[model samples]
Target chain A: MSVVSAEALRERPVEAVPEDAHDDGLAPRAKFLPSLGAVYRAQLSRARVARIPLLFVATFQSIGIMILMRGVVDQGGREAQAVVAGSAVLVVAFVALNLLAQYFGQLRAAGGLDHYATLPVPPASVVLGAAGAYASFTVPGTVVTAVVGCAMFDLPLTHLWVLAAVIPLAGAALSGLGAALGLLAPRPELATLLGQLGMSAALLLGVLPADRMPEFVQYARDLLPSTYGVEAFARTFGDHPDWATVLLDLGVCAGVGVASLAVATWAYRRAAVR
Target chain B: MCAVRGLSKTYPAARGRRGAPGTPAVRATDDVRLDIRRGEIFGLLGPNGAGKSTLVRQLTGLMRPDSGSVEILGHDIVRYPERAARILAYLGQESTALDELTVSLAAETTGRLRGLSLKDARAERDDVLEELGLTALAARPLKKLSGGQRRLACFAAALVGRRPLLVLDEPTTGMDPVARRAVWAAVDRRRAERGATVLLVTHNVIEAETVLDRVAVLDQGRVIACDSPAGLKERVAGEVRVELVWREKAPMELSEVARLRERAVESGRRWSLRLAPDEARSAVAAVTGGPAFDFLDDFTLATPSLEDVYLALGGSRSGVKGLVKA
Candidate 1:
């Protein structure tokens, strides 16, 4: 609370912008965005080295659930397709949702944001870069789960390429949710608990057959961001797939991904300055 | 060069069972102003909770001030923080490097984040690592290193950028004596070779006294004094201090020490006394010239130092926090 002279507080006139003392021009204003590729590469390297084992676990856990469901669901049925698609998407949720929440939560709790805040890069680069890195980690695991689940259920192999788009879009939405939860939680332990609960909800509401659930429960399923992604992938399994409805569902997933990541970016800025 | 004018911040108190329901918010920083000149090492000296970290955060644009502004390299940092980043390199009080990264990678990444090209960042990282004797640990992950090693890596990252301004908070906190000396040598080289302005915030007054060109002593969120080490020490020049060690076989009786009792502060086997400039010479002479001199094993005359100035100005031995009265 050092007192400023009253004159300094008044806005300077436009004409006076270049008139005062100490105006050496050696230092220029920095660009709002640094190289996004540099940030992406660094974040990706960190994720690969620190979280790959967990990614493996996510893949096997999803496949394990599918195998457990094989005994209950009849082969070559829509319910079997739902199980395969939902479990595949669940791997994305495990990393993008459960693990990312813990990462940012621990980062904030340990005062790590101060380092990034002092750098010249834009806050969005950090948000998007870390989100992208964590999402990329899910690609191999998501693909493995999807391909294995399809074979286990005797589903056709022609539509498995849908996973490429499905993984990132679904990953963005879930990772954004995870990042927000981590950044907002007061403690790291609380962030971990919230992340696990969020992943558990995705597993129960997103994977099960919609026909088996009551109408109200289905409404709740529609609210989960990953459900649209699951529905989009599940539609591709039919002998005659509805391409229009598939694109629409995928479009919803993409839209939600953008909106959720935006909120997570805002949350990052809010938490960092505190 | 950097200047902070009229900086102030207030943090809202948490509302819960432990909160005093109607108490006012905590004022972490009160109207504070400071100037760090070009190519000079300026020290911000204070006990804990004196707003040192808060002031540095404002200067580095890590936090927004509720009022006032910081101008760096002739640009107002509050309005153009990115420009500040272009000129200023900061090492925060907390260790902020990514734990999963190797030391060299962390340094290079930090340099890149500050706008260096990959090639230049790598070269700078190599030179700094060799200079700090951290080359041996270049490939080690941060979490695997000892506490001192991690601190050295953080210091290396801050030093390699070669910006015009450097802001370091407790940069030598966990370092050993040799490492501490090495870090100071690096800082000296930066100022001497590059003419960089350094804003060093630390509680290690003794070590900083040897390198600081000027220092501001903060207490209870306000600056109590600002001057060169010599100038600050001169404030108490009228008095002299003497260290005494008494002979175990010939301890003097209290009656014989009556003449020096009032002005003395004693602890254990040593006694310190303050005397007017004219009286000091005679006092030292009397203590050593008298018959009771046989009771003293050793005594040495000394001038007041920056440590004395800090203690005298802070008014307390502990780094306790409270509001300073206007």
Candidate 2:
């Protein structure tokens, strides 16, 4: 069939008019800020719910370990000293479980990144909101760990305020690290592998005594952020608090937390643009 | 309103042995220009690998063009992406809603992000869900819905924001015909009531034809044609098809019959002809005097369609060429 040009159609506008054309008299500018907040809350809620089961299991496990350590201390053995050592083990185990849960959640939630990027809001806000939701997930487990450690280890309950401040900071730092990893890992398999490797490294470096390992391994352990976290957490649960060491560890945790958040934001922006 | 001027994109070869040391880059969009007017359903038609999605991404501010400018509603997509985003909603080819979230939550969240109050967001959510015929499935998790239903849920999320511009990339890819029609109807309503401009990227020509005010056909990263569908169909002049059946068995060696048929077709008498205004009179005269054609039965005249124009413009060739001729 022969086709007409736009010039021809323009001359015969009445016959060539599109069937669906219409003129609506509404202004184009409409505020959409409410929907932006709604999208953020929806993403945050999904992250929170998905990690609940893992948080519950990890909390129960920490409580069980604290109870076992308390029983050993009550028996009046050298194992009483092992209680503080066991607390370090519990910290590593809890953080690892939290990281694993977050990594998988992020891998599953990758599709949402594209959706969020397409929105009018800054990509950084979405990343921060998702990280904030993840931090919320770790709160329940962190509180349980601190509470159980103090009750079972005869920790100085008089300084309870310190535990309150330290636990949340440490939890936020760990969650931030998990978010950064989730953003960087190229695929689900890589995320799983890195999560497992991180857990194993944290267990060996933070839980096991550094002096027992080879000189090179000891040096490597000192470089890990979890080593400082475990150290600070152990001091919080001990009878005598070393304020200087605790302050140093807290600084390290805060630094890592900021860095992790920065990395996550950068990754999110890059993903959005590409 | 969105405009892309001198927009271009190139993908580099993968690293290592597969990559040549100094190979030329693969250009995706080559200095293409477009203007999508406000409140119009501008269809972007192209086959696979024709860079339609890439252009959509650039227009939506998801991907930056290698070099060029994309302005949406007078806001430059790259320079003022945040501002542009407030007025635009993008429904990508892939479903972006979380599977764990219920359909209602998804809608509510999208509304909230667009800055609606909690109560107002919920009210809007209810209205959108009902309007999209998704109220029955609103309580279900996204994973539970069928593919078509899931797409509808995403569509509802995009519409919740009530943005002035909507950019959809293959929005009806997996939808059934009924679902596709429903989306088209919603789009129509949005344009009529809200004055929302739409940029739809799709390979579904027939579906696109139903809503597009004008279409731009892309091939190999260049727009080959841009006009109203009827306008495009008029470009292929002198082409016609004639069907004839005889009462007796077909005659053998009827040179006269073949000659007359050829002359009639050349003169615009066969099937649907595209004769120039001057040629039409003479062509009609020649066909009337032909002896092989005593009385033509069931003859119809029609103009070429967008599909025909698509084939004629080197649709099978390699390098990009546009029909808009400057």
Docking class of 2: incorrect
Model 1 docking grade: incorrect
Please state the error at residue A178 of candidate 2 in Å.
2.5
Error of 2 at B225 (Å): 0.8
The RMSD (Cα, Å) of candidate 2 is 9.5
Residue A105's lDDT within candidate 2 is 41
Q: What is the lDDT of residue B318 in candidate 1?
A: 47
Give Cα-based local distance difference scores for all models: 0.78, 0.63
Per prediction, fnat is: 0.35, 0.36
